[model samples]
Target: MYQQNGEEIFVIDGHVHLWDATEENIDHRGGEEFIQCFYDYHTTFTPEDRQWDLDEYRKYGPDRMVDDLFATAAADMAIFQPTYLTDFYTEGFNTTEQNAELAAEYPERFVLNGTFDPRDGDEGLEYLDELHDKYDIPGVKLYTAEWRGDSKGWRLDDEEAFEFLEKCLELGIENIHAHKGPTIRPLNRDAFDVGDIDDAASSFPELNFIVEHVGLPRLDDFCWIGTQESNVYGGLAVAAPFAQNRPGKFSEILSELLWWLGEDRVLFGSDYAIWNPDWLVEEVLEAELTQEHRAEYGVEWDVETKKKVMGENIADLYDIDIEAKRETFRNDDISQEFGLEDHYASGDPAPADD
Candidate 1:
């Protein structure tokens, strides 16, 4: 929790990953490249002092993640969105099981989101059912660009994909987080297109579709779709850092999202270890769209809007009672350990270059 201008903000990092990208997990060059790519993203946007070394970035694990997000970063809750790249890593990159382990250990702090591949058909559906029963996840993250045997990727509008979505509705998992951001090597760019979300959102009006990274390079298309579909939302994972590195671009993005989807549909996400939530959360709270920019986009960035983006919106999505949860968090062990008497004064230590 962070206090700004006498108002407390309950932050919920809407997108994060707990992954194993160590040298031992690499099955091929793609595995190494994938993590390196994430490292590049980290270095590109991260402040010089906050950056981590390659080794530390590879396996920061749960302790550091928990400390960074909850104890230090002022995040009241975090949602784990897994990205399983089995073809690239021998043990798969960030499986639901790994995320669930963290959620199980710290049940109050994390929300575990499972994943499913449409290509797996009925078997995958059964696996999803088992995951729901075991973990009782409220959402699922879809990486359309994940590489399978020979197939490059699949779309949300695919027949098999629709079947899984229907199952999600039946199982009471209404939140669908889709990765429609930048593409990596071996995964076709077209595979990451946001077009499929249009059809899927239209078909499954009962479910909510959050396009992670806000469809990034394809923001225009995403904004258009979001304007038309009431259930579609924008997840600011990779894009949130721009509030520091490129405030102008961040302003533009926020304006577009507000103009199209409104404040209720835009959620804050740190994307975690790729970029820590502490700085991103602070930056977002302080940043604002200029009057000129707001006039141009016909949208305003007010305190209430920022509050919703920071936590309330996501809390509503996951059925979290913000006030009730905040009360519990204030008395939690992590909060006490961090000596959060002064919420504005972050107790987190600086990252050590290992």
Candidate 2:
């Protein structure tokens, strides 16, 4: 929980992962390149003192992840958005099974979403079923840009992709999170295209489409599509770190999102390990829209909007009762471990200083 103007803001990091890029896990040269690329991004945005060395970045494991996210009470909850690049890693980069290690132990602290690859055909459908049956996943994190054999990737609007979408509808999986961020190594740039989302979102109005990274470098395309589809949303992961070092760009990006998609459609995320929420949350919460941006965009990054972006909007999607969770957290295992019982004792504002 984040305290601002004496008000407690329950934060739900909307995008996160528990991945392995260890040398032992690397199968192809692409695996090495991939983690390096991610490290570049990490160092680019992260503060010098807070940055982790490349060796630690490859595989931070689950225990350290738990401490980083919760010990300081930076984020109230987080979602596990898996990225399975099996073609690169021997086992997998970050599979549903791998993430479940921590999610299962602290079910109340995390929402684990599964993934699907349309290229697998019938077996892919079966795998999706298996994930849903075993985990009862309420959502899926898709990596359309992931590689498999000779094929580079698939599109969200592909017929095979639609088949998987239909199955999701059948199984009552409603949240569809797609990675439309910057291109990573071994993945085709065209594969991360945001155009497919326009058709997919229209075709499945029953499901909610959360475009991760807000299709950076393609923000306009995504914003146009977002305007047409009522259920389309923006997940701020790669963009959120900008508040730390690129405040101007962050203001512009967030202003455009607010102008085009409105406050209810934008969600905050730290993309953990890549950027720790402990400090990232404070930077973002404290950031302000520039005077020029506020004037031109006619939008305010106010406390109310911050509340929605930080947690309320996502809570609405995941059906999380913030108040109820606060009550439960007063004595939950995590609270006991972190000594945060006083943080959730009541929702009242802190007393004014004398």
- Tens-place lDDT digits, model 1, residues 265-340: 9999999988888777998888889878988988877777878899889988999877666556655666677776
lDDT of each: 0.87, 0.92
lDDT (0-100) at residue 126 of candidate 1?
A: 95
Q: What is the lDDT, from 0 to 100, of the residue 119 in candidate 1? A: 95
Candidate 2 Cα errors over 4 Å, as ranges = 185-189, 346-354
- What is the per-residue lDDT of model 2 for residues 27-131, given as tens digits with 9 covering 90 to 100? 999899889999999999999999999999999999899898988889989999999999999999999999998999999999999999999999999999999
Q: How much lDDT does candidate 2 score? A: 0.92
* Poorest stretch of ten by lDDT in candidate 2: 345-354
The true-structure Cα RMSD of candidate 2 reads 3.1
Stretches off by above 4 angstroms in model 1 are 186-189, 341-354
